[model samples]
Target: MTDSRRSSISSIKSDVKSDIESPELPLDQKHFGNTLDQKAQAQSKEQPSEETPSTIPNGGLVAWLQVLSGFMCFMSAWGMVNGFGVFQDFYSSTLIPDVSNSDISWIGSIQAFLLCSATVFAGPIYDHGHPRLLVMFGSVLVVFGMMMTSLCSEYWQLMLAQGLCVGFGAGCLFLPSIAIIPSYFTTKKAVAMGIAASGSSFGGVIFPIIFRRLEPRIGFGWATRAIGFISLTSLLIPCFCIKARAFPKTRRKLLDFAAFKEPAYALFSLASFVGFVGLYVPFFYISTYAKDVSGLEDTLSFYMLPIMSAGSIAGRIIPGLVADKVGALNVLGVCNLCASILGFCWIAIHHTAGGLIVWALLYGALSGAFVSLQPTTVASIT
Candidate 1:
């Protein structure tokens, strides 16, 4: 009986060994019973691999073209927005003469506000890899709004045409202009941004001069139409030239409320909110202020906005250079402090064009620095 039991156990062990060594079985040395070689081959076939480069191509023709495109975006969006002082004057005197200065101020304020506020929606759309589409649509809205503004004699019409339409359009263009640069650059980011931001300063100078120069010859309606044509031409560069380097693999929220939980982000956001509220006050009102308080002629008062914008061109570029060295946040802090002081100093410059000019130039420089460095500063902390 013992002999028969031993023979039966041996036969069962032999059967188990054969099953383990069988060629048809899926099990292998790999974990979870995966056949190592076959699994690897299957993965290779299913999803092709891409090698990530070690370094960003910080300086190249393509990168610089992006910068140029960003520059033109700023020129068309913020440049036109900054030049609203011209409109503020025009609307008060010629178009909507019955409206109070406070009511007229709302038009420019809304334009500036929506230019920034629309980014909440724009940023998410931009992230999903549709930059050219957004820019093309924005360009159309901007030109259309400007043309519509030309024909508007009433307050509500101007608000719809310029404030809501142009502001939302500018918002669409603004995020992609600044956001794409960081993907292409690392060390030279601040300077690149500064250069791109200086486009607004240039626009600030050119738009006012354009409106001021042509308004008399062409009349307000034609003058505005001419400005619209110029905007259409300028906006085309961004629509064609700008391209993004990378896109996120996963989706993100339109508003990243989690970022606000960090103290630095919260404070910085609050400070920016407070700072910008008053910053554009000078840009929008400086011309009107010059006319009211400084007794400057209408022609001379209009030039103040352009001069301020011109100073900002230097402000944007130079601060960016300095920021890359000393750190963007540090430079931004100094600029903000100086800008605050300059804001108060505006009160003291009464009845002198030269004083107002100097004030405007200094204020413009400091404000421009703040504008250019702001994004860089946020990038560092975040």
Candidate 2:
């Protein structure tokens, strides 16, 4: 099946290349062919086009603006997810204290699942041209989800509001951000992506502090509303600024399994799936772990998130710079290895505050590094 798929993709690429090189076509077709040829020649002179791909745009003002838009989109969408620790703690203790950790875990797991899985369809949609509508719809869904979540009390209600609705909204918003970046940066792609991806870290830093402060005075409902307001603001900036530059007018199939034909991409995608499986387990469980194992005070357990977020800030920024220099795959490999080791270390720290703190710092750092580098790794493989 894999070989047949590869052959199909290769045949498609060859046909496209032949069409671009053909001479008996119309004037417009000939002009497009010439443009494609120049692009191919330029790609060959510098690096492997297969590795870099044509989706990347050379850096420019509009390109950087798109990156800025992507940053805002990421910050709002993923930042909310990062801030889940706050929500998890609140809900588990106040509304659903009797709920088992494993059961409550599904709320976050579903959110993360939807957020990641949404990309499968969202990518092709962006390629088809309607990023503006997709983002607008996403923003509306997210705001609505938060507003509705404020009124819910049951487990299913929370899951519907926080897990599925917010997750679906985030998926809609975030897919465009990831897919659109490749449209904007070719040479400075890594650096540009690094800067944009920092939005999540920035959100990590800001949302926790904001939610922590609000939870005391406003209560969970209003605290969430406050966070929702922040998300609203971040999402709006991108809706106005981001755009596709000379995008192709081609139709996109809903599913493009052809992407898996690339062995490197397939491997990286598999690794990504493995890495994400363990990823949210820590994010969701860390606070409970702190409270349960370390016997830490509630306030201290809460503070662990900010500490993790703090390390993540550094983790997101530095590895991005390094990925640009060394190579994204190498950085991702190391980050995953570090995360696996840290997970084991976390398992051992079942009864100590210091050990929990150490785990938080290590896991936080690795998480940032992993997220930041993954895009670059995808860029490298594609």
Candidate 3:
């Protein structure tokens, strides 16, 4: 009986081992398949969640090309505005001799007003992928304005050409360059913008010298045509080069009133307005003031422009670097205060040559600070 029980137990153990080795147990098969599926699903989830790298190339041929394009655009547009002093002098002396300084001031004032005020509408339009059209239209208007201006023999005609047409054109051209910049670059944005903004200063330098030399040799018509040619050349590069990157597909509203919800923007706008009011007065009046009040020669007066512009070159660059460190608003506020003081000083020391020179130097330095700081200030607040 004992032998029979031992044999039975061995047989049962063998049967259990055979059952464990079989592949057709339904519960075990289901659990194994489920485990494999869970692992695969977890891996699939992780694969799609990986971050994408940026398309903005760091300091290569394409990057430099973008910088070059921006420089060209800015030089063509803002450069002309900086060269307004030459126009002011010529128009006041030749075309509208009867017009007072204040009366003639309207031309430049209107141009500046249109240039800035158009930002209200142009910003949204540019953000919407119409940059090429905007830039082309601006080029046409600027060129046409110059062409018409060369033919103008009257104050109103000049105003229409220089103030209305050129101003509007500049606004159109400038919006794209400014708007497209932030799209292409984030890390190198300041450097890129600085290089671009220098175009104005460069234009300021080149145009005055050109106007001074060419006004004597070629006369006003051909001199202007020369400037127009330079502008045309500079304007063309942006048409091909400036492009938006990963811009949103949705249409932005015509007016972004949402921008004003921030108190900082409102304050900046006010400060900018006040700063511009003081800023342009000197640029317009300095040559005349030097010629009439200080008894400087015409050539010397013209030379003052480039000198001030030279100061401005430093102004635009140095403050940009400082703004990154100390805060743009702090730098800008200090700049405005300095500009105001310098303006008062100019008014106070109108009769003395040394004082006037000091004022110019000081004012130019302050203006540079203001120019550099303003953009930084806007960026900071925005």
The runs of at least 3 residues in candidate 2 whose Cα sits more than 4 Å from the true structure, single-residue gaps closed, are 1-60, 246-250, 350-352
TM-score of 1: 0.87
Better of 1 and 3 by TM-score: 1
lDDT of 3 by residue, 178-204 (tens): 666655555565556666777777777
lDDT of candidate 1 vs native? 0.87
User: What would the per-residue lDDT of candidate 1 be over residues 1-382, giving only the tens digit for each residue?
Assistant: 6999999999999998988897454444334455676788896765434324445788799999999998988988898878988899888888889998889888878988888888888877887778888889889988999999999889999999999998888888888899888777888999999999999999899988998899889898899998899989998899999998776655479886777898998899999999888888888888888998889998899899999999899999999999999999999999889989988888888778899999999989999987788889998997
Clashing pairs in 1: none
Best by lDDT: 1
* Candidate-wise lDDT, in order: 0.87, 0.79, 0.74
lDDT of 2 by residue, 1-382 (tens): 6999999999999998988896367889889989999999985654423424465557767788888898888787777777677778777888788887678878878888898898788777776678898899889888888888888888999899989999998899887776677666665666677677777767766887887898789887888788788888878988898786544445558887887999989988888888788786766666766787778998888888877866776777777778777887888788888888887777687787887787788788888877777777887778
Better of 1 and 2 by TM-score: 1
Q: What is the lDDT of residue 268 in candidate 2?
A: 83
Best by the TM-score measure: 1
Model 3, CA-based lDDT: 0.74
- The predictions' CA RMSDs to the true structure, in order, are 6.3, 14.2, 8.2
